[model samples]
Target: MSSIRLIVSDLDGTLLSEDNRLNDSVIDAVRRFRASGGLFTIATGRFGPSARPIVDRLDIDIPYILCNGCVIADRDKIWEMAQLTLEEIAPFLREADQAGVTVLLFGEDGIRTLRSTPETAYFEQREGLPCVPLNPGDEAWTERPVQKVVLIGDMSQIRPLWDRCRSGYAREYAAVQSEDHFFEIIPARQSKGEALKKLMAHLGVAPSEVMSIGNQLNDLEMIEEAGIGVAVANSHDELIRHASYVCRNGYGEGVVEAMERFAAIGAGSKGGNTYVD
Candidate 1:
């Protein structure tokens, strides 16, 4: 394939470690690669604010494709936006309430949930985040349009919810399983692959000029669209099988390894360890 100029990545599982923090090696490799003329950015299911910490750690100033491409942000400014309509989400929300499943709403104001139950509290604590209870006329929900609808609950309840929503509104929304007990609903037209393509086109780069690394089903589409698709060592079976190359390790180390392997040509060496940081 042709040379790559951009590297898009998934955040939680692919780039960040189990502790939810960025790895030093990944940051260094990205800095070295960018310094050598490549651009890097995040493609995640998280809201912009939620992704900012990792972005800051990487020190990348490029526009971020967030909320599974529901929105793209550049230096805190919105570059593109897509969101599920209130009508589209209302039915799902009602269903969750009836099923006693926990629902979390993410947007510009951070994370807001319908009920701050133990389950929801566990999520908030796991992420070291705060949970806002949905109060009628709660300014947060009313003022901020949702970028993603996250739900945490048992398989029996969540499965039926996904089936019900997917059966009825699949045309308007994309129902993705972020975890065994977690499901996220996004706008159907929005995806990291589509957002990456748009961003590359805007920058005058072709699809064959990009490389993408990820480790989840969501990252599969982005990988399929890029010239070189790198899956981390811990990537799911399908992702590993579909990827053009598989990294030697997982998380930050895997990302660093991929960059070192692919960027060597641009730097004029065979997988050189030239990362300065």
Candidate 2:
């Protein structure tokens, strides 16, 4: 029998379809898994503004790793969270601005941007929330520190800064790219891997009993940390190369193939709607 009890997956390029909607096929797959006494949830870089609606729509009853695992939450309770203080990222903000990177700040409450930009609007539309403009000098949210920060801009502009920040800021954050256009900064002390470990302990499961799948650089640690790690076909080369298994399919279809391969999750596990090459 498969030791897998919990299955956590990332959103965006892994679980959601190319159109960015959660489709029936993936929903059906998850429902079947749940009905079979399996636990399923999401581990996404997104927070309440974005991740929660999907969780509700899918009726996911399990805790989700959010903000790159800076917080692990369910509807009523936030089981875990890590705050990034102004002192911690103050230096990076200056460097990012100097490097021509636009910033987006995330907190438990909402998202804020240094100023409105096409990037901010795009992210806002995707998240189904307004990206509020930031006025750091204002005293309104001084005590409300952020949990994660996104630095984004042109690939040429941000990549070199990312390379520098990756090493120079290593001690303060776990910097990784969620997409080619964006770099996410999560506190070094926090990660989806650590959150999964905590959840496993709480459920009385071992490292050998969990499975995880994701596509972005943020997903790297969690994928490496899982007992059975899977990657979508569309994942970055770094993750795809490191994954225990790479799905022939991508997105929601990839998720289905992965569950079938690792846990034989559904009765007709060998069959699904065709979306693979």
Candidate 3:
């Protein structure tokens, strides 16, 4: 049997194809892996409502990471959550809004925006969730706990905010670039890696028994935390640098390649460090 007891992967730009759909090979491989007594799940920046369909499609029963690790839950219940206060986020919101950047707030209630923009509409359509308008002065919205804050804009507009957040709030919050136009903020010390650690403990699995695959900077920590870290062919340069193995294939193909190389079903021994073509 493979030493890898669990496999966690990122969604966009990693497991999902460019068209934002799962490839058949990926589905088949995951089903086979699970059937062989291996556990599988995803760690993504998407929320429960948006990520639920993917989980259902894969038929994963384990708790998965969400909101870039601010929340962990399964279809039936939330196992863990980390939140940020309005005070912690208010300044960044003001700066982003003043700069004409679109901000999306995530909470238990749902996604909300201070003001609607083309980006807001796109986000709504893509996530299949409405971005309800919440005035800056609204006290009711503040009553809800926020799991994450996302700022969407061109790189020119986002870079400054990302830099400022990193310099100013590094001690209190984690600022990561989920995409070229997407800057995300979650509580400091909370990340896909931290959440994965929690899940490992819950399942009584050691770090040496885990393998993680991802393509973005937000996935860095989880990749580093796993026993085998894989970077897809389309991964960010920095993430590739940290990965133990870099795949020649991208998207679901890369996922399948990694599984075949590292977690092959019924393999008597663990796989080696060779890259897949």
Q: Highest TM-score, which number?
A: 3
Q: What TM-score should be assigned to candidate 2?
A: 0.88
**Residue-wise C-alpha lDDT for candidate 3, range 166-191, written one tens digit per residue:** 56653577778787688888888888
lDDT (Cα, tens digit) per residue for candidate 1, span 7-119: 88888778877656666666667777787788888898888766777777788788878888788888769998886656545766867866788888886767888777888
Q: For every model in order, what is the number of clashing pairs? A: 0, 0, 0
TM-score for predicted model 1 compared with the true structure: 0.85
lDDT per prediction? 0.76, 0.79, 0.85
- lDDT-sorted candidate list, best first: 3, 2, 1
**Top lDDT model:** 3
Candidate 2: where is the Cα deviation over 4 Å? 136-143, 162-171, 267-277
Q: What is the lDDT of residue 10 in candidate 1?
A: 89
Better of 1 and 2 by lDDT: 2
For model 1, state the Cα shift of residue 47 in Å: 0.7
